[model samples]
Structures are given as structure tokens and as C-alpha cells.
Target: MTIEITGSAQWEAWQAKVLPPVERVADGLWSIPVPIPDNPLRYVLVYALECREGLVLVDAGWDDDVSWQALTDGIRTIGAHITDVRAVLVTHHHPDHLGLAGRVREASGAWVALHTLDAAVARPGLSPEERSEDIRSHLELHGIPGDEARRTVDLLDVGRALQSPAPDVLLEDGEEIRLPGLELKTIWTPGHSPGHSCFYQPDRRLLFSGDHVLPRITPQIAVYSQTAGDPLADFLRSLERLETFEVDEVLPAHEYRFGRLDRRLADMTRHHIERLAELRAAARETPGRTAWELSARLAWSRPWESFDATSRRFAMAETIAHLVLLENRGELRRGADRPVRWYPAATI
Candidate 1:
């Protein structure tokens, strides 16, 4: 029988008005909720695992005065100082997870660790002009108009400014981290980003699933120039890999902790399957359409026109991901035109 995972009661209570309480999650382990501005998810749960040296943070919240103060105060509640942090294990290079890593390192002299793949692109050592040109070319390749693509490229400046310093330690898949009292093993579960990871503690039957397998929201697996080919396929395989693990509780970066890893994994997998089917149908119905047009045809949380530039960019990337998968599976074919179009593959 597949078990269902109802999330943490304490977290659900605070979802309405207040931040979740900081509590000891396990022996020498504490959960701290740090606020994120203007986001519905509200906060990122920064887990502090204690050791003989000090605390090691699983992920740092956004970098800003508000988030910094919240993280520091939450750590204080657990009887430790932020300066006492020894290392930071980043799950990915997303702003909410890695934004404060540099600030934390500056204060604590802690080593920030990331998978080698993420570390390479975390901060592309390029001049502003060069980076803008790269973004423009990439956006245009995805069928976005030049003017709109330039605007999108300009919007990305904020994200580039927020990137943390290069990682201090480069981690490998399945490599055991030699912390003082923890047996955390890195599981490289890419596709959310090329190097997204989940840390596992087999003895505790716990998994620190970054954005790989969230309880409520399915992590967006979009295809971008930097992203690996067929990201949705990679995401599906990664989900399948998690089904083999025996996990009692899932500690995610966002939302509340939950159990029943297998059930949640199945739900996430089925979601993509349905999405893929939708994309395939969209392609068949509107033959010779670009990913941009096909994406607007699909259902979204809100109307495509209502989306901001960043959201539109992500939506297009996600559309391209589905199209790439369908094309690879012989369900669709790519046209050889500028601003390339997609067509339903001829039945064999």
C-alpha cells in the first residue's frame, strides 16, 4: 500500500499569519524558518545540524537585511550564533537557497559547498556586456522577439547581482561528508537545475530533498541554454531513483516537512506525465507552432499575458522542455526555420 504524507501540524498552523516556530527536529538538529519577501511560500526552512565544532546549515535563505536578521535570530533561538556556523551545504544555485551563503561565509568564515556542475555556472566570470549578449542570443533562439528578449535580459541583472561567491568545497554524488557527528551523503538529483541535490542520512531515515520532491508543488523543470538536454526526462529518472530509498521524514527547503517519500515521488512523476501529454496534444492541435505560442495555449495558474517577464521566460523554457522530450520520443518534429517551429511527427 502506498502511504500518504500529511505535512507538519506546526507548519500548517503558521501558514496563515505567522512564521513557523523554530524547533529541534532531532538530536542536535534544529529547523529555522527564514522569511522571503513578496513570495507566497513565505519562508525557507534552514536546517542547522549541530556538531562538535558548531552548526552546519543545509541551505541559506535570501540575502537581505530582513532574511539575515531572521536567520541569525532563529539560530539564536537554538542556542547558537550565526558566526558559529562551520559549513553550508547548498542544495542548488537558486537565489532563495544560495543568496545568503556569501553573507554567512563573511560572518562565520564557513565553507560553502556545492556540486561541481553548479559551482561552475554559479557565477559565470563574464563582463556585464558579454553576459547581456549571451542572454539576448539565448532568448532569441527560443523564439522571443529581440526587444522583449532584451527586456528579459535586463531583468536578469538583479539575479546576477545576488549570486553568492564560488563554492569553497565541490561535492560529488554519493560522497559522504565527514562532519563531526553527521553522516550526510550527497545524492545528485539533477534536472531542477543541472546539479540539484538531496542529502540523505540513512541511519535517521531522513532526506533533505532540496526542490527535487516537494510535498505540494512540483519543482519546475525547464530547459535553458545552460540546462542539460531533456531536463524533464532527467527529472523523471531522478524521481524514480528516490523511490528506492526508505525515508521516514522529508526536510524540504520550502514548505513543511512530511513523510511517505514513495507516495510523494509517485505524485510528482504522474504530474509530469500528464503535463507531457498536454504539451503533445497542444503540438498536434496547433501544427507548426513555436514553443512560445504552444505554451500560451496550455493551462497555467494565470493567463499567459498576466505573467511578468521572468515568469514568461520560465514558462517558455518549460514549454521547450516538453517539446524536446516529445521530439526525442518521435511524437514531434522540429522545423528548420529561424525561430524554429514544432510539428507533430508523422505516424509510422
Candidate 2:
């Protein structure tokens, strides 16, 4: 299956060609693949670390059997049992990475750790008031239509049902977590999510860069929660911070591990700038155009791309977020009316 990204053709092509490979690169580090069938571009990489204390797994695989079996088999090859895993270090609260945490813990009696920002969402129990408040606030903040918001919230069942329990421990930046012999340092790389953190092993020059920095494509960093602000600004800052690292190899949650960290970062940075420029150009053409209108006007040549309502909504909201950020940066201006909003290019 071929996946299509609105602004990235090359990234889509790379994703189409690469096969998920499980390789043991170091004594304690193993890379396992979780191929996503629905979308070819969506692949999750779970790292297995063997320590003196016990086995430490980073980012649990998907909820399905194929992913679980593949992970278990990979562990067996390394002479590690799922039962021996003493701890599960979750990179973020995304379902793909956090789905199997409980099952893995049940199998291995391992403790689960996540960032505090994500822990709120990853937590299992919520009062009806809390749930309603979360949904209403999130939808209103994002400017999602009421009907669509209702449907989307109703569809959040997958996350609620499949997600493991709330993380027992919270990971903070610069904090080092040691599992037996191997040690990994937590580096806060927010923007993709409020609590996104990537683990870095300086000795090996390996960075487990969750969704913060992918090999080929830029991750979606937008305002989705109740909190409202310029998330794109945060994302740009995170990218700048990632560039300072000596990342010889990046084990991204999605896609293959490769070199050229500086080059990739530069490419991603340029991609964002170019996207902002595109939005500016679009705004200049038709001042005070709504975000949805601008999204429709943006170049989309691929016919095979997913055209479902959810996909359309995500694409439009993402466009609006960048526009909003540009507006905040004085690069654009907005004429707002609640959900129906218009943006224009700011004067130079």
C-alpha cells in the first residue's frame, strides 16, 4: 500500500520502499519493527535493552498478535524473555506505543514509566465530568465542529480500551534511568505532544527519537488539547534542540534507522519553513481566507491519498495550526469568528 502525505512526496516514497527489519546492533539494544497494515507509512520501532537488573523495553508494540509475536520472538533471539522485562519505558502516550504496556507488564512484572504531561491522557480511570470536560475543552480549543467532535470523542474508545493503565512513574528531562547495566537518559522533546520525551544513549550515540524526529517525514505537532497556543513554535524549538545532539543513529518510532542527522534536521527545518511560506503565499493570494479554504487551495496532486473525513479534518487543522503560529509570530494575521476563521499574511 502507498501512503500519501500532502506536502511530502519523497518521504512517502522512502516509506513505500523500506521493509521493517529487526536487527540486534548492540549487546543490549535490539530494534524490532511493527508494520502498520492500514497505512504503509506507519511503522513503529520498539527497542529492547538488556540490563544487569533485567530486560528493559522501550515503547511497547501494537495491540495485535503479529506485533506482539514479533516482539516476543525478537526477545527470545536475544536470550531475553518477556517475563524478564523488569520495566517498560514508554516514549509518549500514543496508542501504538502505549497500547501493550499492561500486557507486557503482566507478562514480565515490569513497572511502566511515562512523562507527566502524557500520564494524564494515559491514565485509565476518569469521572464522567472529567471525561466530558476533557472532550468539550479539547474540541473547542481546536475549533473542531460540534458534530465531528462528538464523533471523534466517541471513537476514542480504542485508546481507552487498549491502552495500559496509568504510568506508575514519571520521566523527567536529564533524568537517567538505569536498567541493570544499560543506562538511558531522558531528553524532553515536546511539540509532537505536550510530554514527548526521547531517550538518548550517549555512549552508543543512539537516540530513540519517538515521534519528535522521524527519518523521512516531519511529525504532526499541533494544538489538540484544551491548552491553546503556538505549538508549531514549540516544535521548531524542539527541532533546534535535537540538532545539537551527536546522533550517529536515530531509532525513530516510525521508519528505518539511518545516519545524516544534521542533514535530516536541516531538511525537516527547511520543510517547515517552506510550508509556512506556502501558507503565506496562499494567504497573500486571497486575504482573510478560511483555513479550510486554504487547505483546499494547497497543492495536492496525489489521487490515491486517503480522502476520508477524518483525514480531511486532520489536514485542515494542521494547516490552521501553522497559520495560527505564523499569525502569532507576526508573519500572518487572522480574522476569527469562533470555528469559522480567516487568516491573512502579515505586512512585512
Choose the strongest candidate by TM-score: 1
Stretches of candidate 2 exceeding 4 Å from the true structure: 1-19, 124-164, 225-227, 300-306, 345-348
Candidate 2: give its CA RMSD in angstroms: 5.2
Residue 40 of model 1 has an lDDT of 74
Per-residue lDDT of 164-277 in model 2, one digit per residue for the tens?
A: 567888988888987657888998887777788999998989888888888666887665444356778877888899888887777778766666677777788788898888
The lDDT per prediction is 0.85, 0.72
- Global CA lDDT of candidate 2, please? 0.72
Task: List the pairs of residues colliding in candidate 1.
Answer: none
Model 1, span 100-141: residue lDDT tens = 999999999999999988887677777777767876777787
Model 1, runs deviating above 4 Å: 1-10, 158-162
Q: Residue 115 of candidate 1: its Cα lDDT?
A: 91
